[model samples]
Target chain A: MNDSTQTAVQHRDYAGAKLGMWLFLFTEILLFGGLFLVYSVYRSMYPEDFHEAAAGLSVVLGTVNTVILLTSSLTMALAISALQRGNTRQSVLLQGATIVLGLVFLVNKYFEWSGHIHEGIFPNAPELLARSHGQVQFYGLYYVMTGLHGLHVVAGLALIGIMLSLTIRQRITREDNGKLENAGLYWHLVDLIWIYLFPLFYLIT
Target chain B: MNEQDNHIVTTKTFAAVWIALLMLTAITVSVAKMHLGAFSAFTAIAIASAKAGLVLWYFMHLKYEKRLLKFLLLVPILTLAVIIGLTFVDVWYR
Candidate 1:
């Protein structure tokens, strides 16, 4: 949200910016949509193996991370709300909280992945490969889906981090904060993906 | 964008939605513990869909956005649904 003249009243198309963000989110849904389609097909093809494989996952960790992501989405949304009300400092603080929550999610993911790896259950490991084909495919989708999701978390953190700085510098003021709003949209989309991931991967067992 | 562009959703509303989302999470987790047979997956997905709706409507401000955006969102959702529906039909019959 930069203006060339710093005093030319700063033209901004708020609706257009938000529309662009939503368009980006649609592509994201389809990107993961293809994966979800793959997941559902495999799941139907090998229901028993899928169920057994999913049971190996730690529901506790999954639930914890789900909570973390959901709360972070709230913070991200609230940060935008705070800015809309001209509460710049509060908005910045909420953005910081969102970043912290996002990092916490990744930390939980690290421990979860490490735990699986320690058990020789990672994708393509000899232990995983020796299993039924259905089980193999299950973990394959698991890693690919969650790994991709974790990357989005990292990108979202960087986006919010930038928005946080801009908000602090008053570059994203109450009147023109489309950048912050777009960042918030991206963060929420990440959370939305996790919502489906948690149940399909962790809870379905 | 006009003055109404500054639609400030109250913090209380946000807090309420947060509580609702958390409650739905808890419900989904608890539901998974039950032996609903094939319905287990279906139920869990239904609950998760509800949670997603809350995030989209409130957190993402889709509820407050223009009508065109609502239609824009319908595009991807419908496309995904059609893809999944056709694939399942083919798989189920074969």
Candidate 2:
């Protein structure tokens, strides 16, 4: 191959890379979308039981977690902004903050789940089964949906953690920060899912 | 597209969006406290949709992305809506 053509082949396509990321994100949305459909069907079938079961969830805790995830999103966005502006130090700090916030969110989720299990409120538990069919369905969807979302949070944290190290090592610099931007996109998508999950599961009381 | 990547959103814009999101959360919570009966779910979903929109447009930088990307995103979204709408119709009529 000619020298000029070889250099062209090595060039990074930032927008193409991001478009690919968005495609993956679209599938992620539909993955959760299926669970949402199940939740909607059951809730419509038994609105009262759904409402009753949802009340068992602490809106206070849910609200706190929501705020935590949202703030992490802000930090993640700023991290990208910082990197684009050539402030590597500030970008690294913001990325670190985002990771910490994600961990804190998981910690809060741990406590919330433990509290529910202590109450014997998990799926297929005797207490949950004893409730109406709709309530049973409600808790089933609750565990699956939130559990899946929590897993995504973990994944997003890992991605951001990698991006953080990359920033510190100068691997993700102003000129080639597509990786960091993609990570930020994934993090924001995680936050977006919770925005819907919060009200659907917690606030429909 | 490379030039678009150079666009640096100000920290002030990020903070403004953050505050707006927090306010929406508060409003949703307060509205939930009221006994709106069947309208409760509708109101909650509406507010949540608004919040989701904000996150997508700003945090995800969809607003800054090309119009073609936005149109591509609508594909999956519209599919979901159709699926939900058809299923609900069946259930409601039955």
Candidate 3:
């Protein structure tokens, strides 16, 4: 078949598109998985310092953020369902809620990080540097992992924003809701990573 | 498209999963406060894994996906397990 003919035939294969997204998500999983491996190795090596450092973190704040993310995931799922059911207005409202929830999570993160920084607890702060090597590693990993996760949250917001616009424009209809579904998948992956991160960083100690 | 392929998860199911996850979070946090030694870590991770499973299966629609897609999802996780296990060997010996 000619190239143009083949392209036309391959268009609108929702399963194929979803498969491509899943493959991309696998790469993302591996990316974070490598970091988790490093975390485990370090935790094993400096068990005491890791525990002590983790104890300084605010479990209340962590739990609150966890709830926020979980709620956002629910809204995201509902948004996709709304889109699939041809309820564009409701879908947009749910998407807005998800985005607002995501922002709230980020705001809480900001305050949390600032609190740590104010207390000289940042990765490279003089206070942190003066701490034991294990403490230093603990803070370093904490910042890096959570920072990366924050970036994912920002990216998810942008993607959802685009989906919102697409929905408004009727580009993403009930029959062509794959993009919205894919966006939900990405958002869930972000939430999924945090599920592991919350326990690893905050609770395990 | 097949009806099953386009299955829509109910809001009730999502709410139930959210409640279960929150309850698990509370349990893990309470478990953390008790000095359970190594078991504390195990319990926390186990709870987190359950929460993640619910999110993956329900929120991410992996349960509604085709069998092949579901298997494909496991490939990366299995690969990571092997990688982590090998790394542990080095850490254990040293």
Candidate 4:
């Protein structure tokens, strides 16, 4: 059942492109999957503590990032469409739009994390001296999962920037834009991770 | 995935997607302030899932893609579902 877009394709870079993307995606899933497994086990182990710790996160920041990510996904879709129609310029613009939005997301995330730390909500030292003191590990997990994902966003932005440069130079054309398309796939995977993360990290009871 | 099918989209499609994303953002944020019991989580996830599907069908071109790729997507999801089931089986007992 490994029949992703990869499809053992040989003789052309299309197969390689899709296959490379799928492999990258698998690695991403594994990365986040490990986190999810940890979270699930810990959540079930200390449900009350996790809830209290989770309540400390800012829903407003999470919501903003979610919107930023959703808009990025939309632009990415349009970029692929532009590429399909041989409109490399428009495609590049759309890709650029996605990159800017991603940067904005990361900037917002930086401020959010800093705010949390300023409040002494660090996993090592939470400020509120309540029964929720033991929930520091949950904060620890939150930082780790979202931090890894933030790194992915930064990487995705870099990939898109390179792709935009390639497109501008007319190197990526309608026939062989597979690399750009696959790059878009990488961005989508980042978006998908947040989709699950938003609910898992922010919406927990 | 259209592959010589000329299933190219118009700027109008992108515009529509922008509008949808804005609406989804608004709704997702507005829902956060509501108290809907367990359904609060479900509502947020439902919206997120819809957003994913929209990206896949339009952005990923799954709608115009070959059947092979379509089925390929299900493999990973199916596998994940099975894994989740197994995890719950173990966790529920412990």
Candidate 5:
């Protein structure tokens, strides 16, 4: 919303933050969308290879991460709401909870990627775990896409931390909480990306 | 906030969404396991697109966003979808 058009503009820092995040998310989707387009085209050309590669991924880990990220999203939404309701204590608490959950996702990713690496399943790692060259390429793209996404998660965590500090320092109030909402929005986009990535990368067909 | 305005989500809503997502996950995985002949590609991506829509609606809060913001967010996806369609039209058919 423009400056004059908003009634609570002065206190709605989160609104502009979310708008910027949505724009950034647009670029990110373009980046990942390009890779996905490549994957989709290749999946059409060589279906079995993609299926076999996807099958090797750990479903349990992916599901766990999904739940974790989803929980974080819930906590994040609640965090902003807490501030809105003028409950700073609950706001800080929920925000901290959200950060921890976000870390859990990264830690899970670390082990998950390392498992593939240990098995010599990475892109440049020549010998696959009894798979094809295309299969290797699939995992390679999976790593690239997810790994980059993991980095974003970390960056998002940093942003969350900043927002958390603001909350503690009394910079963030219910009236001026657009920053928190924007951070939450970006975080949700990350979760949204993973929801698809989970099925796409871990569930083979 | 009125009692109605304080409409915290009920447990049922969360449970329902989770169940749907898990069911969708199971369906996608099982469908992948089955060799659906030539339709496999179409079916898998179709399922994924549906799941993506679900996530966009609930998790991304598109349903709660400003109408203009919603339109702005969609512009990119629509653009990308068109570009993807054009690429397939030119490359896949020929």
Candidate 6:
């Protein structure tokens, strides 16, 4: 490669990359925001049924998952900082911690969902279908919103895994840490969405 | 690249923010148990917004970002507000 071409390849625009990630995050926020709007309208229409259905959700499980996700977000931030400081081992370890916590959150979600399903409270289940219209809509929105958030959690895990591998290979280092920072941004966005979701769905009652 | 120019957020800052977030979470959950009538939802949402703001500013490092990115971030939030506001008006009338 020519000298100029080599220099171009070596240069990394951290700001531009982060700007792109922020724009993508905007779309994500709006995507979830639309669902929240629907939730608000329906909630106003059926406040009582919403409360009744929300009560069926386990506060303990929801609270535990909230704390787990929050801690994972913290670990994600720490991992990026560790990477920036040239401590690849510590960075990889923190990222690993984040992934494990993400898995724990998912496991808790499984138990929570199973508990509801066992009681026949799932969307389109006979028991749920037999409920009042408001009740049915409540469960419907609950599943869709939380299920989508869970998908984001899984995606964050995959991104962090890639980051861990790259850190181990020394491909992402103190000099060029744009990818790690962007991954942290994405993970934080996941946590941000859940921050609102927890209140809107679980605590609003 | 100038490594010194890059803002290295300390462990202390992250820990303090995390603790604050957890405390906010606890407050929201406890307040939910109260019979505050219409204020309950508003209070919970307000607290949640505060938590989201802290994550965006500190954890996401928006505070350290340039003005252009900060303005870009604000645009979407404003747009969302308008959309939600108009929707609320429609819902309120019906």
Off-target runs (Cα >4 Å) in candidate 2 are A1-10
What is the descending DockQ order?
2, 1, 6, 3, 5, 4
Where does model 1 exceed 4 Å of error? A1-7
Model 6, B4-61: lDDT tens digits are 4579999899999999999999999999998686899899889999999999999999
Query: Scoring only the second chain, what is candidate 6's TM-score?
Result: 0.92
For each candidate, what is the lDDT? Answer: 0.92, 0.92, 0.91, 0.77, 0.76, 0.90
Superposed on all Cα atoms, model 2 deviates from the true structure by an RMSD in Å of: 2.5
> How high is the lDDT of residue B18 in model 4?
62
Q: What is the lDDT of residue A126 in candidate 3?
A: 92
Q: Estimate each model's TM-score.
A: 0.96, 0.96, 0.95, 0.84, 0.83, 0.96
Q: What share of the reference contacts survives in each candidate? A: 0.80, 0.81, 0.70, 0.38, 0.32, 0.78
Error of 1 at A1 (Å): 20
Candidate 5 per-residue lDDT over residues A75-115, each given as its tens digit? 78778767877889998998999999999999999899888
RMSD of each: 2.7, 2.5, 3.4, 5.3, 4.3, 2.5
lDDT of 4: 0.77
Best-first order by lDDT: 2, 1, 3, 6, 4, 5
Off by over 4 Å in 5: A1-17, A129-131, B1-51
For model 5, report DockQ: 0.35
In order, the interface RMSDs are 3.3, 3.0, 3.5, 5.4, 4.7, 3.2
Please provide, for model 2 over A35-61, each residue's C-alpha lDDT reduced to its tens digit, 9 standing for 90 to 100: 999999999889999989988999999
Error of 3 at A134 (Å): 0.5
Off by over 4 Å in 6: A1-9, B2-5
Model 1 gets an lDDT of 0.92
lDDT of 5 by residue, B1-94 (tens): 1112223333455456656766776677678668776676567677767766766666566676678777897788898898888888876899
Model 3 per-residue lDDT tens digits across residues A73-123: 999999988877778899999999999999999999999999999999986
Evaluated at residue A100, the lDDT of candidate 6 is: 98
